[model samples]
Target: MAAPPCDSSAHRAFDFWLGEWNVHTPDGKLAGTNRIVSEYNGCVLHERYDTGRGYSGESLNTYDAGRKVWHQTWVDTTGTLLLLEGGLRNGSMVLEGQTTGADAKLTRHRITWTPNSDGSVRQLWESSEGNGPWSVAFDGRYSRK
Candidate 1:
């Protein structure tokens, strides 16, 4: 017998990230906390991140079976919404998207989550303006809290 569609490996590709994490900056200062849960029998991963300093966000992520790609929708307290799509690349879950800022300038965002051998996850967020150079927006390490 074959496994159900939702039980397939692709659907669980992001299982490594399902946990409560204490996120910290590279310099070792606490940046935030994150809680990720698997839902709908592995069809979706929901993420909530909070800095405990008035900035927080939540995202819904799912793997599009037909399109064979992963998609994420992120919304934050600042009234920002981002729709991103991508797949596993070089052992990382990289999702990129674009949005217009309040200044009406186009900005591109790329965020990557890579699980390290030490059981921590590294998240790197990069941004660029109108095809300009990409710069690091955020770099945080997540460990079990």
Candidate 2:
């Protein structure tokens, strides 16, 4: 038989990440820290990011029971909004959608949660534009501090 539908609450896999987090590059460079919160009966995940580059963005994620997937929307103070729609697989969560703008570019966002030996969670974001190339956008490290 086919697998049962994925629970909407399954998206809560990232709930442990709800708090203050410091982002960094694989090379050990400090990127920024963000504060995350959960809203709407644990259905919506909200995040506010303040990168040292003077860029800030708000991310909102909601689980759709009908589609059995999670849809995430990110909007920055700079008028950049991205919509990502995907689901969980293996041990990672994947979201792929597009950017809504005059330029109209296709955007794919893949996120995965890897636990460190130190009991910390590492979340990575890889994005692709126009199905052209894939690049790492953000990597956040949270220690539940």
Q: What lDDT would each prediction earn against the true structure?
A: 0.93, 0.72
Screening candidate 2 with a backbone cut-off below 3 angstroms (N, C-alpha, C), the clashing residue pairs are none
**For residues 1-145, could you state the per-residue lDDT of candidate 2 as single tens digits?**
8544433357566565577777766777767777889776566789888876888898988778777777878898789777878766665666776564576655666766666667667878787777778788877676554
Cα deviation of 137, candidate 1, in Å: 0.4
Candidate 1 per-residue lDDT over residues 83-121, each given as its tens digit: 999989988999999999889999999999999999999
Q: Model 2, stretches more than 4 Å misplaced?
A: 1-11, 100-107
Clashes of 2: 0
Candidate 2 has its poorest 10 consecutive residues by lDDT at 2-11
